[model samples]
Target chain A: MGELYRLRRKIEQIIKDGNLDEHQTKGKITLECGLLLALINENTPDEVNALRKLKTAAEKLLGNF
Target chain B: MKMNSLKLKLISLVMACMLANALIIAWLLLDSFQREKNTLAWQALQGAQETYVHLEENCTRTLSATLAALLADEKIAALYQQRDRDKLYRYTAPLFEILKNDFQVTHWYFLEPETAAPAIAQKCFLRVHNAALYGDVVNRVTYKNAVQTKTFSSGKELGKTAFALRVVHPYYHQGTLIGYMELGQEIDEFLSTMQKMTGDAFALIIDKRYLDQTEWKNVRNRKNLPQNWDDMKDAVLINDVLPNKEITRFEGEIEKIPAAGQILEEKQLGKSLYMKGILPVYDAAQRKVGGILILHDITKINSNMKRTLLYSAVSIFVLTLVLGGLIVFVLNRLVFKRLDQMNQTAIRVVGGDYNTKIVPTADDELGQFETLFEQFRNVFVNAVSGIENAESKTIKTKRPVKKRKPRRKP
Candidate 1:
C-alpha cells in the first residue's frame, strides 16, 4: 500500500509537471504519458506490463521528434 | 512559393524544374544565335571585299581593252608622231565621242615622251576641271614610270574621285621610239555599274594629301559633305562617297584591322541591323592608297531571329506553366489525396477507434502499410472486446450471494 501510494504521488507529480524525462520538464501531458498513468492507476500486473509497454512507446515517440 | 500542402509542394517542384529547363534552353538558343551572327558578320565582310575587288577588276579589264584598241589605231599613232593638233582632232573626233559617251571614259590624254604637254587631250564632261584632263596631274610620276617601262599601270587620280589606268606605249616610225601615247580611264562608270549590280553603298576614301590640293578643295566645296570633314583626317572621303541614306545605325565603332587590310563591324539600331566593311586599296608599289567602304543592310535577318527568339520564349513559358499545373493535378489526385485519407484514418485509430478500416487502393509500399495498419486495428479491437467480456464475467463471479443455511438456523 505504501509503495502504491508513493508510485501514485510520483505519477501525479509527473502528470502535473507534464514531463517524464529528466531534461524535459515543460509542456502538456502527451496522450502516451496519460495512457501510462491510467495503466499505473489500475494497480494490476497486466496493467503494469501495459504501462511498461506504453513507457517504451513514449520513448520511441520522443526519439522520433 | 511556400511548401504548405503536398499539392503546393509538388507543383512548386515541377514548376522550378520547368523554369530551369526553359532558362537553359533560352540561354542555348541565344548562344547559338550569337554564333550565327558572328559567322554571318565574317561572311558579310568577305562578300563586301569580294565585291570591291570585282569592281576593281572590271575597271582594269575595260581600261586594258580600250587601251589595246587605242594602240592598234594606226591613224592615232600617225597623228601623235606628226603633232598635228587640228588634224588629230578631226581624226579622233568620232573615236573620242564613241569612247567618252559609250564607254564612260572620263579622261584621255596622250603624253608626248619629250615634253610635259599632252599631244591630244579629250574629256567626257566639258567641265575642263582636274589636271588629269590636262598634263599637270599629281600622278605624273606614276605616268612617267609607266612610259619608261612601256607597261600598263592603274592609279587613283588626284583632285578627283576617279581611279585611272595609265597605259603608255611607244609609237614607232621605222624601229624608233617616236613618243609615248598614254590612256587614262576613271572609275565613276564602273562604280555606278557595281552599285546597280549589288544593293550596297560604296565609298572611295582617298589620302588626305590628294584632297589637300587647292583645286581639290574647291571642287569638294561644291559637293555636299559633313560639317567636320576637315577634322576627319583619318580617311579622306571622296567627292563620289556614297551617301548613308538607308543606314539608321551609324555608331562610330568601326573596328580597324591593321593586318587584315580591312575594317569590319556590325551595328544594331532600333529594329534594324547593318554591316559595314572597309577594304583597303593598295597601289602597284604595295602602298596603302585608299579604302573602299561598303554598307550592307541585314535588318530583315536580324528581325527574323528576334521574332523567333520571342516566339520560342513565349511558347516555352506557356508550356511550362501548363505542364506544371498538370503535374500538380495528377499528384494531388493519384498520390497525395490517398495519403491524406490514410493519415486521417490513422489519427482516428490513434484516438482509440480500433474499428477504423483502411482501404488500400494500390500494391505499392503505402498500400502495404495501410493493410498492416488495418490488421493492427482489427487485433486491437478484438483484444479490447475480449478484455471487456472477461472483466464482466470476473465481476459477476466476485459478487457475494446470501447463504440459504442462515434462514434454517433462525
Candidate 2:
C-alpha cells in the first residue's frame, strides 16, 4: 500500500512537471494507479460474468504477443 | 542483464576499421623507405665508378709526361755510361727535380737489373733508406715479375697516389730504352697531388701488395681488415673485406672507412674514419689489379639524418596525441556515454513507465532511433489507456440500424 502511494505520488509529480495543475488530480491519476493495484493485488474474481466465453476471449487477446 | 548485441558490435566494428587504416598507412611508408634506399645505393655506386675513371686518366698522364722527359734528358743518358755511385747520383738530380717539381712526385727510384738480391740505386738517401726496410724485393732488380706487375698496374695507377708507385718502362740511354726507370711516389703526397684531378677527393692508390705493412697501412683510418686476412698474403682487402667475386666491381658507402676521398684499409695509418667511395683499380687488360678507393666522412650526414628522424618521431607523436584526444572526445559524445544514458532510459520504460522517453544529443542513427521509440511510446500509452478504460466499462443496449431503402421506394 505504501509502494502504491509512492507510485501515485510519482505520477502526480510527472503531470505537475509537465505544467499541469499541481493541486488537482482530475480523478484520473490516482484512479488509474489504484485500479491497476487492485487488479495486481486481487486473489480471485469477486463476481462471475454472464458471458464467461466472451470474457475468456478478451483475456486471450490481451495476453497474445 | 539484457545486453544489446547490436550496439556492442557497432562499436567493435568502428574500432577495427580505424586500426586497419593506421596499419595500412604505416606499411605503405615503410615500403616507400625500402624502395628509396635500394635506388640510393645503386646511384651511389654508379657515381663512384665515374670518379674512378677520372682519377686513372689524370695520374697516368702526369707520370707519362715526366717519364717521357726523363727519357729525352741528356743528364739521365749518363747513367748508362758512368755506372759510379757519385756520378749516378749527380745524373739523377735533375730527373728527381723534374719528377718532384713538374710531376709533383713525392719520391721516385731507379731500379737496377734482375738479380737474387736486387740492387736498389736511388737518387735520394731518404727514399732509398725507406725502401731498404722492405728489402730488395721492393727494388725488383730485373725480376720479370716486376715488369709484369708494373705493366699490369700502369693504367690504374694514373688516377691515384700511394706510398709506393712504380712504373717500369724500358730504360732508354739515347734513342732506345736500355734498362728501366722504376719510380715510386709517397702515398700521402700522391693523394694530395691527385686531388687536383680528383676534385678535392684524395685518391688512395691501393695495390693488392703489402698494404697492411708500412706507409699504405698508415694512410687509412679504419678498423679490422676482414676477419679472415693473412699478413703475408697479397690480397686486395679494402675496408676490411675482399672484393666480392660475384660483383664485377665494388663501389659504395664504406661501412667503416669514413672519408670524403677514396677509402683504403690501411690499418697501419692508425686513424679511424668512414670512406664513401671504394673503387677497384684495374690493369690495362681490364683485370682488377688493385683498388682506387675514395672516402667521404658521413659523420655529419649521419648526425643530421638522426636529428631529422628524431624530429619526425616527435611530430608523429604530437599528431597521434591530438588525433587520439579528438577520437576519445568524439566517441564519448557519440557512442559510450550516450548509449549508457539511453540504456538506463530503456530500463525505466520496460518497468511500465509508458511515458518514458530518452533524450538524444546526436542526429545520427541512434538519435533517430530514440525519436522513433519516443513516438511509439506515446502511441502505445494512448492505446493502452483507451483499451483499459473501454474494457473496464460495458456499453448500454442500442437500437439496430433501420433499412431506409423501402421508405425511399414507397
Candidate 3:
C-alpha cells in the first residue's frame, strides 16, 4: 500500500511539472488515477470490487505505456 | 410504484366511496319524501271526510232542537186540533216570522198525517224573500224501533227550484197523532260553514233533471259534450265555495258522478293537487238524489316536502365532496407526504449519497419501511468499506511480489 502511494505521488508530481493540463493524453491518465485513488480511499466494498477490475485495466495500460 | 401513481389510486378509491355514499343517501331521501307526500295526501282526504261527517251531525242536532221547541207550543197543538186554517194562520204568522229570523229556516210546511203516508202536504210557508209554495209533499220518514229524527234530503221535484235540509216532526194531540210539520233550511249556508271549517272547496250538485236548461236535461243522451263533461254525467252543480280563479267555468261538473261515495282520481292544476270525494245525498226514500263533492288541495305540503328533500340531497352531495377533499388532503399529509420524502431520500442514496437519511413519521407500516431503509444504508456502507479494505491489501501485496524479479529461467 505504501509503495503504491509513493508511485501515485511521483506520477502526480510529473504531471504538475509538465503542466499536464496542456497535454491531452497525460492529463487524461492523471485524472483517471486521481479518481481511482479517491475511490480506494472511500473503500466501499462495491468500490473495492470495482478497483479489482480497474487493476486488470491498469496492468494492460502499463504494458501499452 | 411511483408515489404519484399511488396517490392517484388512493384518491380515486376515496372519491368512489364518497360518490356511492352520496347516491345511496340521495335515493333514501327521495324515497322518504315520496312516503311523506303520500301520507300527507291520505291525511288530507281523511280530514275532509271527517269534516263532512261532523257537519252533518251538527246540522241534525240544531234542526232537532228547533223542531222540538216548535212542537211543544200548546197554541200550535190547539190550532191544529180545532182544524181552523184561518185561526192557525193568524196565530202562526208572527211566530213563524220570529222563528225564521232566528233559525234561518227558509221554508215551513204543515201536513196531515195519513194512513197512506206519514205526512200529506197541506200548506207551505216561506220567508218574505220566497213566495209561498203550494202542494210540496213531505213524505220522508225512516221508521225505527222507536220514532227517531233523521235528516231527509229530497231531490228537486216538478216546479221545485231550490235544494234544502228538510226535517219532519210528527205532532200528537193527547194520544193520537194529528199532523206533522216539515222545516227547510237553504243548503248554501251549510256548504259555506263546511268550507270554512275544513279549509276545502265544497259543491252541491243536483240531478241534471233539476236543471232548467234544455241542453243539460238531455246531458246523458248528448254525444258532443266537452272533454271535461265525460266525468259529469247526470249531475249539475247547484253551488260551490271554490275560489273564483280556480273555478273553471266547468264548476257545473263537480258532483256529476252516477255512483255514490266514489273517490275520484286526483287531478293536478299547475302546482296544486286536487282530490275530489263524492258523497251521495239520498232522498227520504233512500233514493240517490245528488252528491256533495269535496275538493281538497294537498299540494302545499307535497311541495314543501320535495323542497326539503332536494335541499337535503344537495347538502349531502356538497358535504360528501368536502369530506372527500378533506380525505385527500389528509392522505397527502399523512401518507403521500412521508412517502415522497422517503422517495427523495432513496433517490439520493441511489446516487451514491450514503448520508441521505429517511425519518419515520409514525409507528405504522411506513415507519417500519424507514427503519428497514436505514438498516440497508448501514449495511451497504459497511459492505463498501469491506470491499475497499480487501482490494487494497490484495493489490499492495501482489504488486510487491511482482516487483521481486523472477530468475531468468526462461
Candidate 4:
C-alpha cells in the first residue's frame, strides 16, 4: 500500500503537468464567441425586424399622416 | 459546474457536450414532429370545410328546388287557401317533407316578415322559436354582422345554446308579395361528419370566445376512441384575432390546468403546446366570421420522447460503460502497465538493488522516467563499488606499512 501511494502520487503529478499544456492551446479563456451566441438565443426571431419595420413605417406615416 | 480535477473536468465536459447534443437532437426531432402534427391537423380541418361546404351547397340547392316545387304544386296552392290568418303550417309540412326529411335539417319554418314566429304546420305553434318579426331580426342581424350561436346560459352543464343563420328567399306571386322563407337546420350531423373525418385528432367548433361548442372528441396515441377531451391538453385556442383586432399570442406558459382554454399569461415563460391549428367557420355566403380550432395533443408525444431519451440514455450508459472498460483496459495495458513496470523498477532501485536496468520500449514520457531510473541505478552501483575498492586498498597499504615498521624495530 505504501509503495502504491508513492507511485500514484508520481503519476498524478505527471498528469497535472500534461493538462496545463493542453489548456494553453484549447482553453475557454481564449474564445470571445460564447456571449454572442448566448445573446442570439434569448430574443425572438423576426421580432427585431418587425420592430424595425414598425419604426420606419411610423416615420413614413408621420410624414404623411 | 465545479469539477474535481483537470482529468475529471475534461471527461465531464465531454460527457456534458454529448448530453447537450443528445438533448438538442431530441428537441429538434420533437419540433419537426410538432410541425407535422400541425400540418396534418390543418389538412383535416380543410377536409372538413370542403365536406360541409359541399353538403351545405347540396342541401341549399335541393331545398331551393323543393321550395320552388311547393310554390308551383296544386296541393300547396289550395292550402294557401286560408287568407285571413294564413298559418304557414302547410308550407312547413311540405318543407319538412321535402327539405327536413331528405336534406337532414330537423327545423324548417317559414319566418314571417312582420313576425319571426315559426309557423309550424304540424302544431300551428313555434317548435324552437323566439318568434319575432323577420324584418326586426334581419335588422338586428345586419347590425351584428354575420350569424352565429349565442350562449343563452353559462357554465358547462347547460348542454349547448342555440343560434341560426338565415337563408332568406322571397316568395312573390303575380303582382303581390307573399312573405320571405327563412331556412335553418341544426348543424349537429354536419359537425359530426367533421368529427368523423378527424380520426384520433381533437376537433372543436369554438364560439365567440373561442370556447368549444361542439362535443369534445380527441384521438390519443393513435387509439380509435370516442375520447372525451373535456379537459385533455394544456393548450390555448387563439381567437379574437380579427382582421382589425389587436391581439398577441399571450406569450407565456400555459397553466397546469387540464383544459385548453386556461392561460398562464406570464411573458417570461414559454407555452408548452402540442399543436395549434385554426380554420375560419364560414357563413352561408362562404364568408369568414369565426373559425374552428383543431388541436392535436402532443403531450403524449412529449412523454414518449422522454421515454425514448431514457431508453437512449440507458443505451448510452451501456455504450459508455463499454467504452470506459476499453479506456481502462488500454490505459492499463499501455500507460498503467508501463507505470506498474516502472514502479517496480523504481522500488528496486530505491531499495538499493543495483544492476537493475529497464529495457526502454516506446520513447515516451515513461521512457524518460526509465532513463532517469537507469541513471540513478548507475550512480548507486558506482558509489558502492568505489567504497569497497577504497576500503580494500587502505587495508592492503596499512598491512605493508605495519610489516616494515616491525622489521625496522627488530
TM-score of chain B of each: 0.74, 0.54, 0.67, 0.53
Q: Rank the candidates by DockQ, best first.
A: 2, 1, 3, 4
Error of 2 at B319 (Å): 3.2
Writing each residue's lDDT as its tens digit, candidate 4 over B1-410 gives 24664445555566676667666766776677556555555555566557656755665565456556655555544444343233545344555655566666554433333322355321222222332322232332311221122111111111123223334344345534344443455544544555565542333333333234343222222345433333223323322221121122322222211222321111211344334444444444333333344444445555676677677667766666666666656655666667667656654443334455777667888888878867776886677566656755665665545344455554
Task: Order the candidate numbers by lDDT, best to worst.
Answer: 3, 1, 2, 4
The digit string of per-residue lDDT tens for model 1 on B1-410 reads 35697677767788889999999999998999877776766665577667666877776677777876877778777776676655666677677778778876656656545433353222111111122243333345555566667666665454344355444454455566555545556655544565676766666666554445455555556665443345454555553335453332222322343425443577555665667666566655555666666666678877788899999999999999888888888787778877877766655544444555888888887788778877876886677566656766765776688776655554
Tens digit of per-residue lDDT, candidate 2, span B307-371: 75566556655666666666766777787777776665544443345555677677898899778
Badly placed stretches (over 4 Å) of model 2 are A1-65, B1-53, B78-86, B101-163, B168-182, B188-296, B328-345, B356-372, B390-410
Q: Which ten residues in a row have the lowest lDDT in candidate 1 chain B?
A: B120-129
Instruction: Please list the C-alpha lDDT of all candidates, in the order they appear.
Output: 0.58, 0.45, 0.60, 0.42
Q: Name the better of 2 and 3 by lDDT.
A: 3
Clashes of each: 0, 40, 6, 6
Which residue pairs clash within candidate 4?
B89-B121, B116-B132, B116-B133, B200-B219, B281-B290, B281-B291
DockQ for all models, in order?
A: 0.06, 0.06, 0.04, 0.01
User: Which ten residues in a row are the worst by lDDT in model 2 chain A?
Assistant: A37-46
* Model 3 C-alpha lDDT per residue in residues B52-83, reported as the tens digit of each score: 66765666567667777777788888886786
Error of model 3, residue A64, in angstroms: 34
iRMS, model 3 (angstroms):
11.7
